[model samples]
Target chain A: MPENSAGTLAPPPAAKPKIKPPRRFAGTLYRGREGMWSWVLHRITGIAIYFFLLVHILDTSIVRISPQAYNGVINEYKTPLMGLGELALVIAIGFHALNGLRIILIDFWSVGARHQRLMFVIVILLWIVLVAGFAPRQIMNIILEAQGHGSA
Target chain B: MTTETIPAPRSSYTPPRKRRVNWEKWGWLYMRVSGLFLVVLIFGHLFVNLVSGAGVRAIDFAFVAGKWADPFWMVWDTLMLVLALIHGANGMRTVTNDYAHRPILRKTLLGAILVSTVVLLVLGILVIYTFDPCPSNAIAGTLPAFCKAH
Candidate 1:
């Protein structure tokens, strides 16, 4: 706070950085614990779902093109490969939705912010239950389709 | 030496624009509100379409036709399409803002997101509403059972 003889404020004592801020695009991964991982996961899942939703609309629009055209396209979804892919899609969607709800609660509910880590655990548990229920059915569906029973 | 003038810290700062409305705040709110609805709507959609009946094998022209034949499902589909596109586009915008520091790249990406969102929204709603589940020209097996009356 010293002023020079010229009555001007003295320059800040040659500022030196104690620590450098992390630079973006340095090809270095910034590490974080649970909260950051959750954010990363949410973004990944969201991007995946967004892409799928776009394609889904395009494919569904095939119905208007012609019934046979739609059926031909939709039938591919029954294949074993697509069946497994659907499982992964469900998992992505499952996590995103559950985590999204957790986020909402954290913002809206008073105690939610206090117990975010706990809420994250519960979200995972519920998602597991959800996927557990759906996975078996999906496996069964794939199995049945493989066995030539398309009505499974 | 000249009286080196030093403007007060934080005094030189000026807002980039006069933001009359907080679009970002509204966008954030939209994400949460629409997300709540999407969870229920999407879960129900998955359960009914993918889990129930014969699973993926059950879907076809007839299957989709059967669902859209009902007004309830049409409304549900319409709502989901509108809400999900906006929510997703807003999310993408946030991501773009976060990482895409280059002005040209950022604007291009945001522009693409907006364009795609609008295109898909219009296309999806049109497809859902203007859909002819039972096309007169549709082959016999392609149409749903109720189409027998047609």
Candidate 2:
């Protein structure tokens, strides 16, 4: 240990202040930047789609057990409630796929890194077009069926 | 034993680099490969079941049974099930690693994902392979129209 001019041991200099990690909630949820939001949305949509796959597989498997059991489940999907759920599933899938493409491009292409934000904008635009093209018709069908004016 | 001698201090400290298995690299590659396949498989699946012929109305027990009867569709569906489940589970694992702060919670979530994925994959495979479109034990009215013809 270094000694003072008086030839006695000097007290150690004050320790440097410890740096604190960012709060978890603030780090994850409060950051509203495009990249952060995109990451959050990707995780949310991925989990949603995974759960949907579980139900879809189980329901489809019902057919092997018995036709009546299968029909009971499939027929329920024709309801307006399930139609809306289907719409949500479609939207989740569309976003996940498009964003996944963007991620792949960013990872593999040198140019993609420079213009990732541009790619994200394009993804949103395409998602809008896809939803616009599909939603109205599906919703209209559900409405008409509910009113007994169309085929179920 | 000799008397302890003071060691000289080193000028600097540096971590030794070691070659380790790059699981993340392989995982990233898998995501891209599986994603491309999924696009084709998923869209083809949707188009056939929802947009072809009578559209959604065409997707009854008979529709599914008819598709499963063909070896091509059986192969298609089985491949889709296996690939999609693995891809989705891997993606979820990445998410859990990123966000699950508690070690136990992370382990629990990952375990649940793995278990559910394996169970569903097995169930899906069994359903595709063992499907009995026209079971003799099926009640008279509940059977598909084609089953009556058989």
Q: Tell me the lDDT of model 2 at A76.
A: 80
Chain B TM-scores across candidates: 0.85, 0.81
Residue pairs in clash, model 1: none
The digit string of per-residue lDDT tens for model 2 on A1-152 reads: 33455455555677998999875553322255667777778889989998898889988988877878887788787678987887898889889888889888888898977777778899899999988876876676567657665233
Which residue ranges in model 1 land beyond 4 Å of their true spot? A1-31, B1-19
Residue pairs with backbone atoms closer than 3 Å in model 2 (clashes): none
Q: Residue A29 CA error for candidate 2 (Å)?
A: 17
Question: Which candidate number has the best lDDT?
Answer: 1
Write one digit per residue (lDDT tens) for candidate 1, span A1-152.
23455455556567776897776542212246456677899999998888888899899989989999888898888899999989999999999999999889988999977777788789889999999999999999998988999753
RMSD of each: 11.1, 11.3
Task: Give the Cα error of residue B141 in candidate 1, in Å.
Answer: 0.9
Q: Model 2, B105: alpha-carbon shift in Å?
A: 2.2
DockQ of each: 0.53, 0.30
lDDT of 2 by residue, B39-107 (tens): 788868866865455445446687787787789999999989998899999988998898999999999
